[model samples]
Target: MTTPQQPYQAPSAEAFLMGGGGAPTAKFPAFGTTVSGRVTERPTVEQQRDIKTGDKKFWSDGNPMMQLVVTVQTDQRDTSIEDDDGRRRLFVKGQIQKVIADAVRAVGAPGLEVGGILSVTYTHDGTPSGPGMSPPKQYTAQYTAAATAMLHASDPAAASPQYAAAPPQQYAPPAPAQQQYAPAPQQYAAPPAPAPAPVAQQHNPAVAALQAQQQAQAAAAPPPF
Candidate 1:
């Protein structure tokens, strides 16, 4: 007899992102709060709802949501690790991840490395997709100089290279010019020969004497064989 293949079930938010310590907190921080630090944990897939509707709607990854957990030490930090509290874990996606990952890359990182540091603020797109009226809010990532500046300054690495995407090729703007005509080789008259320098009169006494002396010496010198 063959055993049946079971359907995929998503882990709870408490089990989200590897279920490290416990499920994630009940809520993410308010919008626009800057969060910055190295990514303590790389991105992972977890279901959005603890209870699977059995319909794998998005990405076909079984409603697997992409999450990258980072530790923020800046004032934007919602919690403290040193104090035994959890760090702020930003769940990034298109609007937010595009902005933040771009900014992180702009700041000297080849890309968003695991250990590589990052700092970004976030806001909700206000689109909640869940069962009841008070469904969970979807958030978009935001980038700021004040928060991410240090991240740019930092040089961190990840356990393995994954998130760092290849830099886009930047070609020069093709030199904004139409077919060059080269001014048609500007031709002008040569302005006369400067009067040929007045044909300097070498018929002077000293020159004449020197010539005479040289000629006499030549006459006196024996001819070559």
Candidate 2:
């Protein structure tokens, strides 16, 4: 039974991007609700892989393609997230996914490794299946950046211990261009410092006084005179 109501289309890729994944605007409510934490688990990706660019892909407006099982740290005894809420998102096609992917990569997050600080603003509204069908699998509200923030904020030591931008094995310090001169460990310790040289004594006042006394005694005897 098709009713004569305005079609409620899901937001577009351009819409998400333009909004900075929902940049908290005055018109829109402040992103008071945030994800429990940064997304630690990798994104679950689906849909026809590589269907050639430029072709239009199908979008199930209400169905979520990626169900992000995110960890929320809130102790909401009165809320739905008593256990864990999957901050799922939908990707109509590979292209649209790439659009968001590129944006995320540009964010320069330290790492997406689980247990990072991931927070976002999302609405609690559910998407209904169109006219005659049952509602598709429901999901957490559309997860989006509350403001212009990264979905993955890496912990401080992430870029250091876990992975560094520099080449050599991951242990290398973070200097990109020039080699860092870090003090070597026990095995590679630097050579020990040299000892100071012994200084010579130039002013012997006691020796000079003794010589003068002997000379004065010989002169007083005056044996030659």
Candidate 3:
């Protein structure tokens, strides 16, 4: 049986510029000044071309020159770079690449991704290598991951809490074992009380007889007097 082909979906303008398997019919102006926005397209590398001649460019080593492109939904209006839809395509190279790469590394991410927030500032111009050539532009950049950016966006209060304040549930240490103390072991039984001492019995029969005789003689003498 022959399988049916899937319908082709037209790529967005942002996708077309970011090397998303689309023809380069659209041209997006390079970022001229500082811009801040949420990333709509991930970073993509494409061959650099001459602006005037529309010919592929190469470096001194004969390798094809490459440029990194990223698309962002801008936060504010900037007529210079952003399109009518408020999306700006960042054509990153040379000094700008180093700045963005350093920022990504600082955040411990592999690279920029969709839904992330990116802010790039054109700080100043760099010293030119030759007299006739123009000076290179310098830049500084900052990035926030998608998850972190979304968290802050969804709940503004979430950003105020520090990581140290609330550790992840999985990483939290188990509660310390409850302090346990056992009562002193009870004695099996108290020692039995000492046996009472035996009492002595009077065995003086002779003294009893002498006392009876003296009492009888005194009675007889009193009657005579």
Candidate 4:
């Protein structure tokens, strides 16, 4: 028989960001560039609600809604100049979303949710340089420092050899059953007779003998007391 699935409460971004019993740190790949400073903007909350009870649609693996906005410095190369310095500088921005499993594992919120934002610069159509001059220039690019900082946060187990292998199967050994014997024709045995009790009473020999005789007579009779 298939086991019924239970309703899952997605953990909050804070919980995931702040691992249980510890502080939360980003686990994604790093962003931003080597040339300029990388900064983290304060985190913000986005409220979500469930539209249906026991909704399987949202229960399946899904990405968190949280993402980050990253800003990075980029420069458009100036064909007019000779070296790399000749490039004209410009700022670029983009958004990065959260992974589902990681989000669900986060702390505060329950259900699939994401936290964080995308860094500034991203790839899009345009010459490496500023406003069009026809020969579209290209520039060397790198992730911003903020974006790069989380490079290893998401994958804590990647370095382990066991992470790549298949999980082990769990099977319990069977238990032994009770045995039964064939019934035989019945025969009953009589219980043993009760043992006699000793009497300690007389001061005179004559009285003692008489009392002993009386007690013996009482014991010989059928048990009525």
Estimate every model's Cα lDDT from 0 to 1: 0.49, 0.38, 0.69, 0.35
The runs of at least 3 residues in candidate 3 whose Cα sits more than 4 Å from the true structure, single-residue gaps closed, are 1-32, 78-83, 156-225
Best-fitting candidate, measured by TM-score?
Answer: 3
Stretches off by above 4 angstroms in model 4 are 1-132, 135-155, 159-168, 172-225
| Candidate 1 lDDT score relative to the true structure | 0.49
Q: Give residue 12's error in model 1 in angstroms.
A: 16
Model 3: lDDT of residue 121: 82
**Model 2: how far residue 127 lies from native, Å:** 16
lDDT of 3: 0.69
lDDT of 4 by residue, 1-225 (tens): 233444465554544674452122222123323222222333333322233663322223453232322222223344444443321112221112332223223433342212222222222333444455543222233232232244544565643545665689889988888687868755544334434434543356776677677777766776432
Better of 2 and 3 by lDDT: 3
Per-prediction TM-score to the true structure, in the order listed:
0.36, 0.24, 0.55, 0.17
Q: Ten consecutive residues with minimal summed lDDT in candidate 2?
A: 22-31
- Model 2, TM vs. native: 0.24
Error of 2 at 197 (Å): 98
lDDT per residue as tens, model 3, 1-225: 232333354556655666443322223235456677888765677777797997767767566788877877775555553345566677788887888889888888788989988888866778999989988777889999887889787774675554335555666778889979988765555334434333331245665566556666655553321
- What's the residue-level lDDT of 52 in candidate 1? 64
Residue-pair clashes per candidate, as listed?
4, 5, 0, 47
After superposition, the stretches of candidate 1 with alpha carbons farther than 4 Å from their true spots are 1-31, 45-47, 50-83, 123-225
Residue 58 CA displacement from its true place in model 2, Å: 5.1
For model 3, what is the error of residue 185's alpha carbon versus the real structure, in angstroms, after optimal superposition? Answer: 80
